[model samples]
Target: MAKISVLSPFLVLFMVLMSSAPVTGQDGSRRQMVPAMFIFGDSLIDNGNNNNIPSFAKANYLPYGIDFNGGPTGRFSNGYTMVDEIAGLLGLPLIPAYNEASVNQVFHGANYASAAAGILDATGRNFVGRIPFNQQIRNFENTLNQIKGNLGAENAATVISRCMFFVGMGSNDYLNNYLMPNYATRFQYNGPQYADLLTQTYSQQLTRLYNLGARKFVIAGLGQMGCIPSILAQSASGGCSKEVNLLVKPFNENVKNMVNNLNANLPGARFIFFDSSRMFQDILQNGRSYGFSVVNRGCCGIGRNRGQITCLPYQMPCPDRNQYVFWDAFHPTAAVNVLMGRIAFSGNPDFVYPVNIKQLAEL
Candidate 1:
């Protein structure tokens, strides 16, 4: 694996070439890198699917999208998610939430991310009204049917095969389910054992997506969740929790191995694993060089580390939002999101293996 820096000359060249591409569409690009981009994940990538749900996980109010063009759109960040940035890099418009997307919009893509959602159905039961990954996939099938109705079965299959699928689930499974006291998961299995359990379920879900005409996949591993403001607030020393970080290591390892297995066994399918943990580690370790001042607390929210709760409606966030690594207790600010997105777009194999999103699109 090539551990390339963000300033790698090759990455600089790649960006130059991409920016120089011809313009034709309403967007600046001549053509989209892919036919469509389907997103599946939790609040980290959720655009607005949780708005109407009867859940406490919703984020449709102010200070949330203060930096966004359309204002708060249920995105947990001040502006865009990593996927939103990736979508723009792909030369496509931002994908709409599954609930809000029109049939016409489905041709481009739809986001099925729900806040507090997870890979397991029961993972976020405490949230009351989140759509789990399985339900999200069912919703995708509905969208696929619409695609087939409009484009015909054969054409739809061909187009769908070329579409990109961005999946970034499992954070909620750790944060909301397995770690919660109300849930019996911790007692049932130890850390590594629990990770194995989650991975088994995750493997099956990816296979299901593959069976549903998905060919190009970008499976994002869990980030450095233990270092999140929420976990930092929980720590007695007010430092990142090693115990919490260790728990997700096996999960990421298993997913990387799973990506390899899937690519080898699945015919015509190509999958890439995004090493989100490593990427975040780089940011945390070099926050100063990255131009960040606050790496331990959220720009919004109150209490210890400003992480006891997510940001509230109409809450006044910090003035220097870009200097803060966290937007809230659990989410990264747009600054971090965009950095991670672009890195995944063209980072070396150490970050996204065996090829980055741009290379995968070309294939």
Candidate 2:
């Protein structure tokens, strides 16, 4: 394999030229921003990596992707995911799950995300089986090796560095760890202390990606976890839990800081932090503005608030999925995902700070 130092110049020149040039597709109808997109994190972007796992976090059945053209390809949403929208905006095809990707398919990048996965390995023990952030990075390493084998080391380095990485994680850490009754993380550390621990670990994980030839990154922050239907169902009035929301603030703050530090510290590394909290809050505060009527309840699922239980196989979902913000208990519907993707792709500084996805891809 070619060494990092040997491939640095080619990677740098390639990125510079690609950034300045307008990427076009075969039909020449749209401009392709990035060569490919690589995804990480949890259920929010799992695609289908969890389908073969032993965990109950799978989502490859009916009512899950009814809105999607392929129909339930293991995406938690009804149609597309944030990654899908972002890939579409970049003029690239939908990336395949890492487990199902063939050698040829991997040239477009892979999705190693898994449901119930978190930044910490122990974060999703309740689900029994998951590819944690650490293991996901390892999977990416294997991907890098495969790319090197396919395209030769220099071309592989250039392709990998030029590709975009979208990471949406950390919610499970709060839901499955700090907030779980069986877990002692809450007692072991306060909100701020736990956030600090998560940030420290996250910094290392990102740095590992940087070392593995990833240069462009889109890191999404945690949304209003307390406002999700599942959490709201726990309340008597079905109101969002202020306590839970407050607990997540520290983690988001730390993540933003971590991004800033990475940009300043890592040469050639361009990162964008997507503010999911503000994005979700805007939709919840003004649902009608976004064409959403039910921001609190999920379109699918059972019981009060339609969140006591998740959307099971053969269960009928809402008539109009676009009218609902959330698809199931904890995941957003495809409508909201596409909205978030558009914002991340070209939204102003308000949603994506420092730089948006378009700017990052161009760089």
| Best model per TM-score | 1
Per-residue error for 275 in candidate 2, Å, reads 0.3
What's the TM-score of every candidate structure?
Answer: 0.93, 0.92
Report the C-alpha lDDT of model 2 over 242-319, residue by residue, as the tens digit.
999999999999999999999999999988899899878776776764567888899999877888999999899999
lDDT of each residue in 1-363, candidate 1, tens digit only: 123355644345335634753222125643688999999999999999989989989889999999999899999999989998888888899899999999999999999999989988998888899999999999999999999999999999999999999999999999999899999989999888988888899889989999999999999999899999899999999989999999989999999998999999999999999999988877777676567878899999988999998898899999999999999999999988887887788788878999999999999
Q: Residue 358 of model 2: what lDDT?
A: 85
Clashing residue pairs in candidate 1 are none
Candidate 2 residue 279 C-alpha distance from true site, Å: 0.7
Model 1 global lDDT (CA atoms, 0 to 1): 0.89
Error (Å) of candidate 1 at residue 230 is 0.8
Worst 10 residues of 1 by lDDT: 21-30
